[model samples]
Target: MRIIEPVEITPALAVMEAFLVQPSAEPLVVQVGQAFQVASLLTNVPEADHPVWLSTKSYAVGDVVMLEHRNYEALVANTNKNPAGVGADPPNWLDLGPTNRWRMFDDKIGTQTTNPESIELTIAPGRAVDSLAFFGLDAASIYVRVVDPYQGIVYESSVSPVSTDGINDWYDYFFTPVEVNEDFVLLGVPAGSYGSIEINIAKPGGTARVGALILGKAAVLGEALYGTSVGITDYSRKDRDDFGNVVIVERGYSKRAEFDVIVQTSQVSQVQRLLSKYRAKPLVWIGEASYQSTILYGYYKEFNLVISGPTASDCSISVEGLI
Candidate 1:
């Protein structure tokens, strides 16, 4: 579900009174002088239809009250008739409701296989997978068997045996890095051949009923190979008495190419002094040969720099700015 931010509305005191009378489909609705019980799976009790209300002075006859679902507390209602707590039940707890179940299907053809078929899983390599379990609903005991093309019999389990007590929920087949020797390899299957997971019934009277065959992968290792490192340099060209040196600004690791750098200076004069030195006649060299004699000038006050080139590995920059 998508989350949306609420729009801000401004209304005058007289207009607010008229706006308060409108009914809303929000979770809470308010009515003046009338008491209502908050409706929820737990608080509404056995019937699940009780309405909960809060008293408000400005509330009109049909005005709606919106209560944030997270803020309200569930408690037994107090009344003048039952003030002594004589027949009052314990406060009902709030219920958050059920989560949606995952859905799966075969490729248009309703065919379930048991023989060794190559299954191509788009999974992170070397990660442990736990949700890759197989089951079938039949009046017989069944087991799920899997064979990896590169690594044979990566997973086989008879623990989730079928029973008469309806189709069992998808059981998790836990596999650590040790179970699957190699990293998960995605292989292409031939036109007729495909990766197979089998559901074999052990005995009669038990039927093989299959739900969606589900598989999920999670990273086990804290770090992966897909990451990058950056090196930065800051040259201090302030005085002729001092030697120019580069200062490392930031050091971080990312799995992508982009990065950021921040330069902090005591005064703007330091930057100007550095730029003036670079603008002087300088000898540009590529490899061991002097390519050109030119002056490099620093343009902008703030440098929003991006470095990209094919031969970046062999490139280096040296400036004779004031130290």
Candidate 2:
């Protein structure tokens, strides 16, 4: 078993590719017998093009601006009004939520960053990174490339998320819903200074969405015992209507797990330090490398350790995931 200590990709550490779609600065066309022209609308603007909310600038209706990591659109033409400040009783701005370029990095797994067909980014960690994990993915495949300054492209690999498991019989193959992996990890990134990692996601004819990306060095905790357990915490609601019929309200769910591990006595301090350092932070906990069900991206609820012998100790942990 191993835990990946995540590296936060701040604005200084990486640069995301520009979102493919952007609103035109000018009207797209002039309509006949109409007083207003068809103006191009902005979807997600690039960092360079994103306009910051300025108290000295006057805004017109349908204008968008950024303030405090969130985007807001002007509901009515106004001047010197702060979008984030509480001035008017009902403010003249409508909250548009986080920008598409930063949705994936916001630590909210349910809010995904999406783009048509594909999404790409380049990042420099300034340190060695051995593992990269993705969660809440809605893409066909992932490609990773590492480049070293002296040797050029040092390593590259790609993997598909589509899973063809549980298709034993002919009928099952045809009737079963197509299942794909929602989370995946890429390992063995070459270690080098002045190097960068380039990631690309491809989903032809559909939106390529990613909720969160974790890049870090993995630390071995212990050997995950065979009796580890995994399940989900569902939030769906089911109620009986007046007509005695069942009514279901669908909602999201989060994965959960409980596991035991055996670790060397000498490494107890190291393991405890790692756990303490990331107690409140989310991380990739890999229980068994070959089994996809055993890997969870979340925080540990609780953990206890007991010294069993002179050389080894027994540890138990429970983890709860972010939706």
- Top candidate by TM-score: 2
RMSD of 2: 11.7
Q: What lDDT is reached at residue 291 by model 1?
A: 10
Candidate maximizing lDDT: 2
The CA lDDT at 200 in model 2 is 87
| Cα misplacement distance, residue 165 of candidate 1 (Å) | 11
What's the TM-score of every candidate structure? 0.18, 0.77
**Tens digit per residue, CA lDDT, model 2, 1-323:** 98888877644433333222124323222223322211111123244325999999999999999887678999989988888888686679988877777777777678788888888776666567889888888899899898664467899998898766788899988998987677777777876544667788889998999888888898889999988899999999999999999999998888899988999998888888889988999989988766677778899999988888899999999998888
Candidate 1 yields a Cα-based lDDT of 0.24
The alpha-carbon deviation from the true structure for residue 10 of candidate 1, after best TM-score superposition, in angstroms, is 53
lDDT of 1 by residue, 159-226 (tens): 42322122234433222211210001111211111123333433343223332232323111111111
**Over 4 Å off in model 1, which ranges?**
1-130, 133-139, 160-196, 201-206, 218-323
Give lDDT: candidate 2, residue 243. 95
